[model samples]
Target: MSYPAVPRRSAVANAIYGLFNPIPFGFFVAALIFDIIYAKTGTILWAKSAAWLITLGLIFAIIPRLVNLTQVWITSRRFSTGADHVDFWLNVVAIVAAILNAFVHSRDAYAIMPAGVWLSVLTVALIAIGHIIIAVRYSTDREYFHG
Candidate 1:
């Protein structure tokens, strides 16, 4: 089966795409690092807040765009490689989990709910993986393949 040609992005657009592309991943990595550091230093409050920040960041800023882009990426990959369903579902679940975590963190229950923090952290990790996959797949120079 033939795949449609990928559109050529302008330099500015490419840079913006590259910058926006890794936001989810970066949030995840930061959350994880903060969690580990806080845990080692016995700063549970900071750890929890960092995890909440990551979750809120994803829910408010990243997840919606991520969902849209992921859908496009999945469709393109399926069309181009004839690949079966992959981790797309996992990403969706992570988005949902992050949303839930954000909701919980916004409430008074967050102070006592370690599970919520962990779930938020896990969601970030999953989203980061999803971001990495999409970035690698789409951000490459199309000229290499087209030429």
Candidate 2:
């Protein structure tokens, strides 16, 4: 029996995505740590730093996500998987939280307190979950054969 052809990923796109995907995670994770520090110390500097970090992370996230969006949803039908869909939604939600956290961080440092910190936590957690899904989706060792 012959199987239908599967769409192969472009090497350039894959390379670009692999190179850029982890960058936003680092920035967002650092932002979460900074948010926690601001909560503890009530430091305006920490709040400002976190806001910058979140902004940078969002910017960095654009490249990999755009690549993924095109590959998974727009350009290729063969590539769709449940984990890909889940990861995509998780990233969308995380980005929203990060944007809200940025706005919250714009307020007085003390005023930002729990909400800003909590938003950061939410964003980081979502991003982490998304990453985990991607990792597991690709790392599985099992193979299936159709007859």
Candidate 3:
């Protein structure tokens, strides 16, 4: 019986790939931290709820990353050329969305309410699309490995 060899990766690439393995857990931790902070700060109940909801969304967002990490850990053992770039952009979009949400809730008018709403909506949509793409790619790659 013959078995396929695992793809080799450099130390740095392996370490970077490994770093992503905990993204889901880290996201959960971050969400909990945000919830605690918001609650402690005495923000309005609605604001606290918003923070919690956003955190939940973040947890959802991390699922695809976790899936990709599993594939990399078991097979490639490296970040694919575009994976890191995709992660970076996805994070950027998420952060921008979060900032826009904060601005909208703060009511300080740092950004116009309409603009903030649009930004937040666009960011969320981008994040969702990115996750779907990553999840599909990871599943496909995993199947290739097993086959």
Off by over 4 Å in 2: 1-7, 141-147
Candidate 1: C-alpha lDDT: 0.57
| Top candidate by TM-score | 2
Return the candidate ranking by lDDT, descending: 2, 1, 3
lDDT of 3 by residue, 1-147 (tens): 675665555566447545653453344344444444544564455344544555555555554555445544444545454664575467556655765555555553222334434544565556566667667877877887886
Between candidates 1 and 2, the TM-score winner: 2
- Cα deviation at 6, candidate 1, in Å, is 4.7
lDDT by residue (20-109, candidate 1, tens digit) is 645665665566566556545655675666656666467455544554454446434444321113345556677677666556555442
Error of 1 at 65 (Å): 1.5
Against the true structure, what is each candidate's TM-score?
A: 0.53, 0.89, 0.46
Compose the digit string of candidate 2's lDDT tens values, residues 1-147. 676554478899989999998999899999999988987888689889999999999999899989989888987746678888899889989989989988998887588888988998899999899889888866662332232
How many clashing pairs does model 3 include? 0
Task: Give the root-mean-square deviation of each candidate in angstroms.
Answer: 5.5, 2.6, 8.4
* Per-candidate clash tally: 0, 0, 0
